[model samples]
Target: MFELTRYDGRRRIRGSIYLSIGLSLLAAMVIWVYPSFEAEVDLDQLLAAYPEPILQVMGVRTMASLGGFLSFELYTFGWIILLGLYLAYATAGTIADDVDRGRMDVVLAMPISRSRVVGERFAAMAVPIVGANLLPPIVVYVGARLIGHPIGAADVLAVHLLSIPYLFACAGIGLFASVIFDRAAIAQRVALGVTFALFLSESLLTGTDAEAIGAIAPMRYYDPNAVLIDGSYDLVGAGILLAMTVSFLVAAQLWFQRIDIS
Candidate 1:
């Protein structure tokens, strides 16, 4: 069933390795610097000086401990926004790039059904998505211990595990874009724009009368700070993200099946 998935998945291995190394390095750097940052700065006062809205937007509820510090300075920015946008941007190109380069015709000429093609290609996104999530937590745990500010092992694990669905949801947005637009450039741009806009809307609109408007955003479901700092895991949110990812993939498959990919 996943023949094309296996073929396409092999191509992403190197990119996945590179992504894992990059994230691990970033995690090491963030963890290494936390002690120095805590020693030099009055984190509470710094946070107080910042506007409340800005703090809320950044998900910086607390910066008092290593867990809180890493949550605010590392995972919230690096994982939630940066990684999410990256997957969205990368997945945006998967199908549309092939179509734009005249490769889709060759792909369609094969015996595979269009829905299977879409499903398998979208399935291949797991290579990078899972790769990026797998190693960073190990780095984070080891780094925190080396820095003498060891965090809860479960918390670190929970945050990474929960992020998978959130990231797939982000990639799902890109998959939808890839099918809707034959031009890779436009698909990528639109995916990035929509993903980022959802982020902004989720961050800026929380607690306001229009907060519900951001409900569709995957960011609404994933809360790194809540997990890392407070040891709070929202399984319900993860399930919602999983559902959203499935919806996007199914929608893309249906759309691709109906469209003329000429």
Candidate 2:
């Protein structure tokens, strides 16, 4: 069981780290290339064009805002897409892959109970997300600090931490989907599709009565600007993220037990 856990976790961590490496490098490059941290032209004018309620929900205040940019640009309200993609790939196929690829029979011959097997495997899948949540900021921070901008470390680290809830939310969604379907492909699609819809809907409803859609997107609650630039952390939203992870994990266990796995 321990071995399986390590195996699963390593696979997930490696793949996610590789995927995020290029993006993190590019972000660091751009941050260094810019003469000023702030964008050109008057950001205030662009900010004024936006609706007040939407701005409040997004926790955005200025045009040259790092908070708004992290939530809006890096996460793009589509962070769920990447998060789900990683989770779906890592988890949706865990059990299905073992069975389809003829590893399940061999594993069952070991001393592990069914529940332990499922639990360990699920844990393995989470390792990658933890790595995903951790690594990129290191790359970005190292680059930023090398350019004589010590604060870039805090900037990248903050936004990446803000992503904690977003990424775990995606992982949970995938875990639940993994328990729901028999096929890895179907599970992946279900998890990714649900996450995509949640975030995409929130973005589309940015300034309307439907703006409440954002509350459903865990990514929306994280104001990267406050943490990254303003240096303030969101304890309340962080609590929600932790709670959501627990909930999804519980749901995955329940459903996995209720269903049959061959």
| Model 2 agreement with the true structure over 1-262: per-residue lDDT tens digits | 3888887676666576776775566555555553354546565676788887666544556645444444444544334455556665556777666655667768878988666767788777656666665656775566546755555556666667766666776677777777677777787778777776766676567778988767777666666666666787787887787788778778877776677656
Weakest ten-residue segment in model 1 by summed lDDT: 70-79
lDDT of 2: 0.65
Screening candidate 2 with a backbone cut-off below 3 angstroms (N, C-alpha, C), the clashing residue pairs are: 67-225
Report residue 156 deviation for candidate 1 (angstroms): 0.8
lDDT of 1: 0.91
Best-matching candidate per TM-score: 1
Model 1 Cα lDDT, one tens digit per residue, 25-80? 98999888888889999988889999998997887888878888888888888888
| TM-score to true structure, per model | 0.97, 0.77
Best lDDT goes to which candidate?
1
What's the number of clashes in each of the models? 0, 1
